[model samples]
Target: MKTFIAVLTIFLLSLQCDRFQFGSNQTKDDQAGAVVTFLQGNIFITTQGKESKAKIGDVIRPGDRIITKLGRVDLQTYRGEVIRIKDNSDVLFRDIAGASRQNTDIHLWTGNLLVKSVKLKSGQNLSVTSPTMVAGVRGTVFSFELEKGSVPKVKVYEGAVSVAFKTSPKLIELNEGLSKENYTRLVKTLEENEVVLEPGEKLEVNPNLNELVYLINAKVATGALTGDELSGFVDFENGLSKVNAIVSPQEKAEVETLVSIPGETIQKQIDSQNADNTDVTTQTIEKEHSEKRIEALNRIASEAEKTGLDNEEEIHSHYSVLETIHKANGEVLSGAVVAQLGDIFIVHSTKGVFQLSVDDIEYVEYRNFKVKTRAKR
Candidate 1:
């Protein structure tokens, strides 16, 4: 009888393990949204205020939050779409195959995500929202990151993505009357809504742009400004404040006409002014360029700047194989290729950060690095 009891106990343990591995209430329909395919390190799923360690084959529905502390996790949605949540990330599934919704919404409170999305069926959408910006994609492979103390960025590898600031001006606030021509222009600006990023394009929304909107709104409330010129000010501020794209001295001089402070003062404020409050533009030539890259590229650039290009032979010895992307149309992009997610390559060039697909490129020369730390995502 002891031998029979031992076999029965082992069978019961197997059933209990299945019950714990996959959630107890999982159904076939639950797999339509988020189903964990792979997990490493400390991954947790919080549902209804309770947290449990995540396991492979666990189905996470709407209103669930995935928190990664020391590792990474891969979630599979319907149609084989994969979303990789990198380490030190916090993401929430706001809407995923809900009863009344056709879109799958992933809201990243903090950290990085690499998304490989499949073409949606009719009337379906996929959106990712960070604190500063929102990206709407129909079918695309993309990377969206919200790193601390840095601007939120979106890079599209394949297909297209429409991106816009969360604080973009709303049309409902245009209460004042205007000419038909002016009204048409204002509506057009607001309706454009977001920047449509094609394949090989990337965008970064400056955190300061939201502050400028607040300043504009305050001025409008005091009756110092009117509705007719609001769009121009917003468009101008958006264009200049974005990183990687340089803002000229002439444009900086013109901004004083729109706001109380000089454009230099605004830029100074964005940089959080040195303790001495001396003008940054006059001190560092690098600050004037308005060029921003991911930390990896910044590291390479900083080392090069410290050891002038005259010492190229010494510098090239430390680094092997600078990354260069050659497009099929004969255009060339050179930068530090930071991260590779499947066929998508995220390149940080002097011009800006670009996410390009292997399909769009004729060939690529890249380096393999041994580093102590990597850029988040």
Candidate 2:
């Protein structure tokens, strides 16, 4: 009997440690990707080779792909950055890191995207790549479109973005000893081929030029042009000069204005739903809940700090304080507001991840660490 009791105690301790480690690992993985904030029409997310209709709160991890057909979806990554996947689009979340000086890489196979990126920390990077071209940004609002058989186009609204054709593997395999002089010139030209577009600027990349050596080899085999002539042609075709002119201010506004639609529509929905919430009883209850939420966040923050944990750990600890979201309808949602874009709030709740518009919310009792109340819309 004594031996059995001792063994049971040890077994319980081991199980507890394993449980803790499992929870830790799960949280770390969740921070590595964007979360689906809103979904409309038909959208699918494929993960681990299984595709399912995407729902709010789905985490788009590395290797995951999102397809939107006759629908639109909004995803909020770390620090309030928003990516709006437009209709008839297919995109893959290649990689993401949500830490300070973050890096996010996405592949857009087809369709269009409107991105409202946050101001990036130094060393941060955000990139979108298609089959033939890639666009890199530090911090900017931009639009990216790539349709099959057509050239990829990038349009900048607020900040600068670098657009370039993807380098060819064949170009890298060229023999330096066979023709050192030609090889050196070709490599130098390709290195300088990227174009940077400022605000309101637009550029289209010719996909055929992506494979420099393939083009040159084909031309040479046909005796169409000498290596030297092809080198000049490559330079002319893939030069740093903008292929398309800068869009007009009106056009820039028209493009940039897309970022606001989600927030605006959510507000309209909220206003329509909240029309009956002007009663004294509803106001009283809202005020009480708001006060309680603020108190809960402060207590959580205080307790975590009191435990002598680091800032990052303390932030994680605050997730215990279930946030309250009063929907325009009589329903209430309890979750943590993980990310926000304009007036839309992305909440990680007990039920699931949810994207709620400020207009649809009576109010949000956000975290004390970065606390702010969303006024009743």
lDDT of 2 by residue, 125-211 (tens): 677877666677866888899877677778887788877655333332223222445444444545566788888678854444544
**Tens digits of per-residue lDDT for model 1, 341-376:** 334455445445566666867987774533456778
TM-score of 2: 0.52
Best by TM-score: 2
lDDT of 1 at 343: 47
Candidate 1 TM-score to native: 0.48
Q: Could you tell me how far off, in angstroms, the CA of residue 205 lies in candidate 2 after the best superposition?
A: 2.7
Q: Against the unseen true structure, what C-alpha lDDT does each candidate score?
A: 0.54, 0.58
Stretches of candidate 1 off by over 4 Å are: 1-31, 98-101, 167-193, 212-236, 239-377
